[model samples]
Target: MSVYNQPRKRVIQLIILGMVSLIVVRLFFLQVVETKYSKLADANAVLKKVIYPSRGIIYDRKGRSILRNEALYDLMVTPASVKKIDTAYLCEILKIDMEEFRKRIANAIKREGRVRQSVFASLLPPETYGKLQESMYLFQPGFELLLRPVRSYPYGAGANFLGYIGEINPDQLKKEAYSAYQQGDYLGLTGLENTYESTLMGQRGIQYLVKDNLNRPQGPLENGEFDTVAIAGKNLRLALDIELQILGEQMMKGKVGSIVAIDPATGGILAMVSGPTFDPNLLSGSYKALNLGRLLVDTTSPMLNRAIQASYAPGSTFKPVTGLIALDEGVITPSFGYPCHGGYVQCGRFIACTHKNPGHAANLRVAMANSCNSYFMHLYRLSVDNNKWGGTTKGQVKWTEYLGNMGFGHRLGIDIPNEKPGIIPDTARMNRRYTGRWNSCSEVYVGMGQGLLDLTPLQLANAMCIIANRGSYYVPHFVESIDNDKSDLLKKYKEKRDVATHISADAFSQVILGMEDVVTSGTARGAQIEGVAVCGKTGTAENYARVNGVMTKQPNHSLFVGFAPKDNPKIAIAVIVENAGFGATYAVPIASILMEKYLTDTISVKRRPILQRMMETVTMSAPMRAKSKVDSLNSVSYTATAGEELLKKILSN
Candidate 1:
């Protein structure tokens, strides 16, 4: 070898050594410093499982649990882990055909890829669960039984407001609010459940399990060192009296209307009943989907919470508000009198009054007691035409302001979903309705609680609360408190709203006296309770329905609004019976019975016959009665014969 050739060889050797060194460093970084590959390898050997926490229970006022949880099982499957197995035997136990099994398998694969788990059969019946548990080894790595909690109603009442839960949908999954939820998670679907979902749905936990050769879980990975513990949901305490709620439902059965009762001091709901309601249990567990479909298609609308959702004309029950507004505007004193000969004929329209006596409209208290249409109409005209406001539009705006303050024309912010803010005619609404050329006489029927005035039974009951409180009220809510909760979920409900503070106490006193007279000697004489000093007003709202694209008059809806023990009032209520003859007949008696039951805790012996008749009364039309099977669906055997027999037994005792 030559010396010059040796130098070139040494230089080439150095270059090759540098390249080898660089390769070694890169390999060390990839294998030791980076964690992405290690995680991927662990994923293959580890099974990730989500642990759902127990949902909260709901309790009524007296610590009785209205809603409870029951343990159910869901059949889950991993398509990738599936091997040849006895598919037919499984189908037999599940009560499904081969076609359905195949379809479910295909759907499971499509929903979540082959490696991930999906719900194959959910909320399994107890018999199927037992059979599956015994033969679970045959399915091996693919099928698993998971524990699930389902809601159950113990009292089988309050279907309209208690609500139900359902599986989260695709739309909800994409939203930021539901970012933590997966495709198969369940959530509150309606009513109170929907409103307090965030507080009721607790934190989810995660666990890792070691996988065997066939991808089956053997045990907890690393002794559960990386597992997270789930937190249970907080319980809700409501102000509902279950017994009163049951009685309200009984009185409303076989009828078409709503009843709402409130505690005047706290604005806590005692009972709310929407007639033709189905059992709440129908919306839980296995039959939820089928029963929900039936309820959706039923013509009677059993699912609607009509106490807050349905709007009706206030009728004469609203006359007290008109009188209060008139007194506040300085348009008339309580002693201001008007003479009416059966009706008001001055506006070129004869608005009839129920009483034809001369002194019926002589004063505010007397007029309210009589529910005199002419007196209220004249007061509305005088208030709107007063020279101080300069014009009818300005006067109408002021009147609407007063109404808004008194919990009208807007939602009262109840602690539930789907509360309807009933319609109230304002200046803008009047302009649109009358094309900008309207006068006080144009909407004078509002004074008598007719025309464009519409309110919910909830609103009527709340108005009674305001009057009973002498112009102050709390926002009506079902939940009084939450168990072990620190959230600001109930901040608004605790605050008092003095809406009618501007109105004089003297004005309220006159209205209260008039309502007292209503129960004693006026339209709602049937609402009187012995030794209770009940103050109430009755209303007969005119009903019109569109049939075959033509307007037809139906029977008037009977309504009653009242508060018991006039001073230091404890209970305030509103009852409406649709398509009934007069307020005195059905609405008055229903309200009176409920008030007596709540205040005295039992019906007197003398009123036992009236309770019996109310329990047996059927106000539903023949076609409606035949078409609806809600009573049967509820599993409550309510027959006229049964009611009579029960009443006879009570009376005999």
Candidate 2:
């Protein structure tokens, strides 16, 4: 009994001692050896602050910065730290009433809880910021002024394309794409800003500071050892020519339209102007929400980026495509001709031709030059009814496939957001529209750029690039490169695309020759520039809009598509003026002036009068003109009054 029981007791004591030693070591490590627990315990006394990086700068072609960052102040508040401060004094300095102050405080508390800081007043005006900065001490630990970088547009053009940044909404915060963003963070909402958001929004930094019981920052915690430094966002270099953009905007004043110019060599956008555009600064700084609200409610829809968004029938500007397609399909040759005394009357529907001359529809070049409806209508019919394709259904399928390769009826993958893929009627679509009883004659008007054919101004400009490049193109893009960037963000844009590889170069040359004649002796005579050969086509697209619950035909939309230096084209452009008369009147002159300015960098003295007249022209309806605030909003550089005064002075001279 004594020997066996004593050994068991000793074993139990040894086990108890080992367990106690392990517990002592674990406690010592948690208390003194490890820093994780220490940092966790220090969290109550330390203030965690986020250091925001500077957003990227946007530069136009020729190294000009289109936008800049301006210093602005945001009044932030922590509900828990707020005490019996002079609310009336603070409201008076902020130019807000006591009720507003209380409401803001309640909202802040509701959003971020009692201790965390939330914005009380955002993007303060200079005067308000100055007043609040001087009296900041009175607010003590409750309120503080934070420096914020606000975007300011110097040129005040390209508002629709440049876009604006807005605070992240609750819905966006939950999305995986925006997971990195917080509720109070600002992000690109539309246009180019949205397209390059990740590149433009740099890495965020974290800073920990020692704070007192009252929540005022005493000093940096651990001398900023644990803080992360913010890296500023990369700068963006755009292909946009600011000067060209400004000129286009000035010419398009008091008009509802868009202009898109692309560099055919690189597919880089030189200038894109959406008329009735507002100052980009209006969507930034103190009055961002107010100005945005006004723009949203405006009848003219200045916020719409018509260059890539609005769809319209191509009109005669589409005639070249019909000829090219017909030539590629072997349905017609350059010498192919159709007889047109007055119009097309084969399908029991009369489609009028602009000219009834004896040889107006003689050969492809002549037909294109005259924009003869009969010739193209016949070409469309022949291509769609070709015996090689078996039937009309198969023929249309092949035709649409060719059109898709030509970058029609689909998005061109531009850099900006919200690019609408224009409509191109395919076999299935035609079948649905006509209940499967359709034939080539049912949609023959498409050959002349009408009837089930719709395209954006961007697509039109890009198609010209295809012709200008002789059957090849690059996807149109705004940002040419990003500073200090190594990402493949621009790889697709740099790659050359051969959209019309099947089409012969000679076919393109024949179409281009007709376009050249269009400026020289045909429809777009007003588009001629001395010493430079401009190949262009005029379009007066038929338009219909519902007014008073009834479909009514509005004024035709004036349009022109062209490229300069015909042989080695550099710039390709498309312009559309809604509800304006003939393309030769409004669109042709504008395109001519823009081309001359871009190629030579200065408008010739002889063309100054044309420029002045174009600047003074107001194509907007009288009622719309009265209701529009865009003219006043874009007063930063190009104002209507200034333009009128300049015109008067020019005329007097």
Candidate lDDT values, in order: 0.87, 0.87
Task: Report lDDT (Cα) of residue 258, candidate 2.
Answer: 94
TM-score, every prediction: 0.93, 0.92
Model 1, poorest ten-residue lDDT window?
Answer: 637-646
Clashes of 2: 0
Candidate 1 collision pairs? none
lDDT of 2 by residue, 386-465 (tens): 99999888999988987898898889999988999999989778989999899888888899999999999999999999
lDDT by residue (tens digit), candidate 1, 1-653:
89989989999999999899889988888789988777767767888787878888998898988887888889999888989878888889998999999898899989886767899999987788999999998887799998888988877778888889999998989899999899788888888889988888888888999988788889998999999998878899999987777777877889999999999899999999999887788888777788889888887889888999999998998998888889888999989889988999978988888889789888888888888999998888888888899988888888888788888889999888889999888988898999998998889899898888889999999999999998999999999999998878898888988997778999999889999988888899888888999999999999889999999999999999999889999999999999997899999999998899888877888887888898899998989888876766676421224224433444454
Q: Residue 224 of candidate 2: its Cα lDDT? A: 95
